[model samples]
Structure formats: structure tokens, C-alpha cells
Target: MYGHRKNISDVRTPDRFSYPPSPSPSSYSTSSGKSTSGRSRVRGAARSVAGVFVACFTPPEEDTHHHSSSVYGGVSDTFSSTSDFSGASDSTDGRKRGTARGIYGTRNDSTHMKEPGSVKFTIAEIHYATKNFALALKVGQGGFGTVYKGQLQDGTLVAVKRAKKIMYDNSIGGEFQSEIQALSKVEHLNLVKCYGYLQHGEERIIVVEYVPNGTLREHLDCIKGDVLSFASRLDIAIDVAHAITYLHTYTDHPIIHRDIKSSNILLTEKLRAKVADFGFARLAADVESGQTHVSTQVKGTAGYLDPEYLRTYQLTEKSDVYSFGILLVELVTGRRPIEAKRELKERVTARWAMKKFTDGFAISVLDPKLEKSEANGLAIEKILELALQCVHSHRRNRPIMRRCAEVLWNIRKDYKELLD
Candidate 1:
């Protein structure tokens, strides 16, 4: 039932004003609201710099009884006088209303206003939610810091990411504020929701939605649950595409997700994906100002970083497109971007997989954990073809995130039709 045409331009892009439709059984939904007329002004600007994807957190146990030694007293007197988390109301209505200033800003600074839905959490409330950062409640840990499963007095569950002391003292601390600004501006179904943050003395913590299931990396490795079916993987790829699309097209400013690896992709109990971790995220250079790409020190994981960015230090949304290409290869091959155990030629999975794909052996690179079906075989070929374009050395050769999502939508539609 599907056409053999694999040309990127052959598949029509979804309306610029709207998002791609949600796939069947996926909780992620697209908003039908049309974007304003100016949306397409920078449509071609998508060729700009790359960014990393969000970070992932582990799931915690249900029990909340454990309580570690209180770290409250040391910084209590300092921030308590500034933050309003000690308020009596547990509901949003009772939360204090004040300007959302930077961690170092003064209390009465009217220069910075809080974004809607943004909250300023107290150290006491943070300590209570995380049970004093108890080891038993720890969910995930990464370069950013340790994540804990926490419950508020109102019984709302959240993932509390506490920056390590060293990270707080390093460049990552700046990323902390950068992430807060980035997270505050965007909201989408496939993106993880940010609840609030805590900045007490040496403690720098971010509280976000608690996604119970582990990360996409955990699932791909089969660490958290069963092997992901081809359909599930396809769905996740689309979900992430939607998230990136939102960041690039829908936000007031185009945001580049510099990191787009599997570990940065979090999964839910239903296997729907949410793009997390904004430490490496950045706003695209203002297209309105006629600037095309932002020039900055290169940052990102080794295997997933865009080559052009590394060589030239210029970044564009297409940089993320390159990383997404690497992620697609990882999903299909079930191998890390770099596999030291493999032969020299095969050491870089993306290169090896692309070689196989171009040599007319695309199906040969399919993840061994997946069973090969007629539909599955065809899907692999189409996906790799897309990945090929995405990973092209030249940024202009890559498809925009919007185009990527559209291609994936067609792939899923065709695959499901073939299965039926």
C-alpha cells in the first residue's frame, strides 16, 4: 500500500501552523491551533546549529519512609529569608506570588518576572519532598546530578534533580540557570514538564514531572523491561521528533536540543517518550536579526556531537538533526554510537550501519533483539534512508525537524497498514 518513493521532498510536510498528528495509542497529542503567519519566516533557518537532548531520571520505589540526615540547617537561615516555600498553602493558589529572579538576584528585583506556572520552592519543601535526599529515594544520576523520587505535602509526585557540589561550582551551574530559562519558555506534550526549582546555599535542584518508567537507553538495552518492539521504537522516534519540532518551530525563539541521545529520552509506563534534560539546550540565533547560526564553544557527548560544529564551532538546528540521525541508528542497531568491541571498520556503529545500508543490506543492521517481519524489514530500509540524510556531513543536506517528523509519520502509517 505504500509508495516506493523515499525522496525527502516527496513526502509533503505537515502544515507549518500545526503539529504532526499523534500516532495511535500514543498519549502524546498535537495541538490543532495554527501558528501565526510569521512562523515560516525562519522556516529555512532550520539549517542552523545543533543542541543536546534532555537528561533522563531513574524511577523510584513507592515507599517514602526513609529520611537521611537533614542538610537544612546549614543553608536554612540564608534562603529561608528570601524564598517563600514555607507558606501554609499546599495548593497552587496558596503558593506565593513574586517575581522569578535569578538565583543571585535580589528579592525585590522587578527586572525579572516569573513565567506562568513557574514556582519558587523552599529548601524545607525541597528537603521534605526528597526525604533529605535519601539514598533509598534516589532515582537517577548523571553529569548534572542525582535525581530522587519525591512527594510534596499535597501528594504530588516529582523528580528532584540535585546538582552535585562540584557541578554547582563548575560551568554546569551556569547551565542550571540556562536550563531553567529554556524550560520555562516551552511546553509540549512530548516534552517533560518543569514544576519548579530550589536554589539553597550549596544545593541547586530542579523539580520536574516524575516519569515512572526508565529512559529509552535503559529500554534499548533491555535493562528496565522487555525488548522494545519495532512499533514501540518507531513511536518513540516520532515522539522525540515532535518534541524537537516544538522546540524549533513553536517556541517564541527557536531552541536547539544539542543532545539528542537515547539516555536523554525518557519513557513512560505506556512507552511514550518525553524529551528531558536542558543543560545543553540553547536558543537559536535570532533569525529576525538576520543571523543564521550562533557561534559558541562546542559542547555535547562525543559520539553524538555534530562534526561540522566541532570543526567550525558554528551551530544550527541542523546540528541536532545530525545527532538525531545518530540516535536513529542506535534505535535500529541497538548499539552505542561507538562500540569499542566491534572490528575497526565496524567500531563506529553509524558508519558501519550506513555502509551496510548503502551497500543494499539495510535490513542486516536491524537490532538483533527485534524479530524480522515483512513490514519490519521495509521500515528499517526507510528509516535508514532518512538517517542517511540526517547524518549527511553538510548541514544543508539535512531535513528540518518538522520534515523529519512528517517522514516518520508516513513511515508509521505505512508500517501499521502493512501489519494490518
Candidate 2:
């Protein structure tokens, strides 16, 4: 039982959630170097960051400050490149699909207004649900703010996210708007659902579905729950693939999940994976706009960021593909992208594993905790092969999310057959 606020240390990784701050005030000013008013500057910055971020619960740190942004330029819709994803698509049994807001002196007017259909929770109701933000109700914390577990009058369990006040002065306000915009537009079995939101004077709170199980990062760290078997890991991978696929292709305008790491992946009691946090999410370029990628500021975690995105500041769906590739390596090797404690050659887990894979020792990269078998070894090779394609240096070479999902389906089918 999580009786105390800090008791859920096992549920999240504190050191993994350090998001880099958004661009400085200079980035928000006009080309002439004229200083913009506070209102204009905030609005300009918010438009720049059309994404969301929901870091896992870490106890609030007084000295810690963080910012979120969609610093890149124009949005484009270019999900065109698709490599043949021919793989074993054997039919499998169907699985069940499962499915925020701020406070204020009540400033209901934001350039990024919440779309209709998203319930608006009054500040008073939020206070009652959260027991006035009592320490006991706290579930998670991060650079954005603190999260508390609450139950609504209708008996719906929700996770209420409260942004740090200082964050309002920076990009948190934009992050909040971007998250609402992204979450409000999409619904998928593998994505987290938004319940409502409350925005009081200085307080910004987003209410979301409560995921009982801890994050995938916690599970990989062996700090929470049961060992994740190869089969379970595969299922979770497919679930995530589905979520990303929905975001990239099914949405009215393609959405790019700027950040995709283990810490942002929350699991349900049934061990189903739900892609959480859209603070770093933004709309992709419009296909009809004759654009290719969203030229946004460099945003995303360190190891998982695409090399091309960093170099050119051009973002595409393949950016997510690159991160997913890293995620695949993480799942297979059960190692962080960067293991600071590792030796010189082994420090970067992805590169180290890729070397082992290319040298005809792919199985060597397998997590020692996993059982070694012909099926498992073969699955690892197949997965890393797909991962290799994902982490390709060029975005064009990386497979689309839909293609990745297809390949994973085949891999899962083959893995199941090998076991039989």
C-alpha cells in the first residue's frame, strides 16, 4: 500500500526524468531584437511548443526546475516512405483494448483552448477530490509538477497533474496547451485517456486515467512487480506500436510523439502498456502543405533522440521510429540507453548491443535475466534486426510505425510457433 507520498520510489526512476529546459527568452523575441511584452512572449512560446510531457512521480525537489517546448518551426504531413514489411502475419486471438486540466482565477482563455468533449472540472471539485493536494494523496512528481491520485464524485479514479507555478513563466503553459490539444484529438486502446482538467488562477491541473501498475522503466529495473517474460515484452511492444501507429496515421493530422522512452510508458494491472505523456507531442506537417518535416527546436531525451533531428532540427514520424528502435534495444537487453556505470566499450548500451549483434553474437546482448533458448535467441536476433532498421541514421531508412507494427506482429507469430 502506498500510504506515504514518497513510498512509491519503486514505481519510478528519479534520475531518468531530467528534461532539458526550453529555449531562452531570446528564442521568443522577434528578429529585430525588440523585446516582446510578457503576454505576447508567453503566447509565442506556447505556439512553439505544441506537445505534452508527463514524467513519472519523483518527489518534488526545491532546487530542480524544468521546461518543455515544441521549439521547431513549421509542421508538415509526410508519412510517405514505407518499406515492405512482409512478415509472418499468422492470426492470433484478439485482446481487449482499454482506454486533463487546470485551475485558475480561472483564466479560461488560452490560445491553446481545450476542445469540446473534454470535461472541465471546477477548482473546488478538484480540491475535494485531491483532499486539498495532501501529501498522502501524491502519486508522482517531476519537472512539470506533482501528481495526486483522486476519486471523482462519480467514483472514477484519476491522476491529477499540477504544474509548478514557476513553470508557468516559461514553457509549462505551452506544454499544458499542447497536451490538451493532442490528448483531446485522439483515442486508442494503447493510449492514456484524458478525463478532465481544472485551471485556477496560478494552478494548472490535468486529470487523467489512473494506471495502477508502475512504468515500464521500473519493471526493466527490477524494482517493481514480476519479471517481464519475453512473451509479455513482445505484447507490450506491439501495444506501444499500435499506439504510435494510431498517432501517426489514424489521426486527422499526423501527430509526432516527440518523446518516447520507457519512463513515459505506463502499464495497467494486466501488464498492458499505455503510451503516456504528450507534453512533447506536436502535429506533423500537413501532407497537402507540400512540406516534409516539422522544423522544430531540438526536444527529446538524450540517448533516444534522433541524430538527424539534432543536426537539422527537422522532425518527422521517423523521429519516433528512432526512439522506438532504442526502446527495442532497451527491452531486449534490459539496459538503459546509456549505462554510465558500464565500461568504456559498453557504456552506450545500444551501440554495444549493436556491435554484439553484428559480430554474430546477437544472443550475447540478451538480458542475462532472460532464459536462453533457441526460440528466445532467434527472437532476439529478429527483433534486433528490426531495431537496426529503426535506429538507422537516416529517417527515410527507418520503417514507419505501421510497418514496424506489422513486422512485430510477424515476429510474435514466429516466436509463438517456435515455442510450439
**Top-scoring candidate (lDDT):** 2
Q: lDDT at 81 for candidate 1?
A: 8
What are the per-residue Cα lDDT tens digits for candidate 2 across 1-420?
Answer: 100011111222122232123233222221212233522332222221111111111212232233332111111111111111112212221111212111101122222225422888899889888999898988877766888888887777778888878768546676778788888877677777777677779988888777888788889988889889999899999989988987887666778887888888889899999888887788886555356676666566756777666655677788898889889999989998778798966867776766565444778888888987777877776676677667665565566777778778877887888788
Q: Cα deviation of 85 in candidate 2 (Å)? A: 33
Question: Per-residue lDDT for 257 in model 2?
Answer: 87
Q: How do the predictions measure up, each by TM-score?
A: 0.73, 0.74
CA lDDT of every candidate: 0.64, 0.65
Write one digit per residue (lDDT tens) for candidate 1, span 276-353: 877667887666545667766656665776766665556688888888988998998999877879886676787677
Candidate 1 local accuracy as lDDT? 0.64
Clashes counted in candidate 1 amount to 19
Worst 10 residues of 2 by lDDT: 1-10
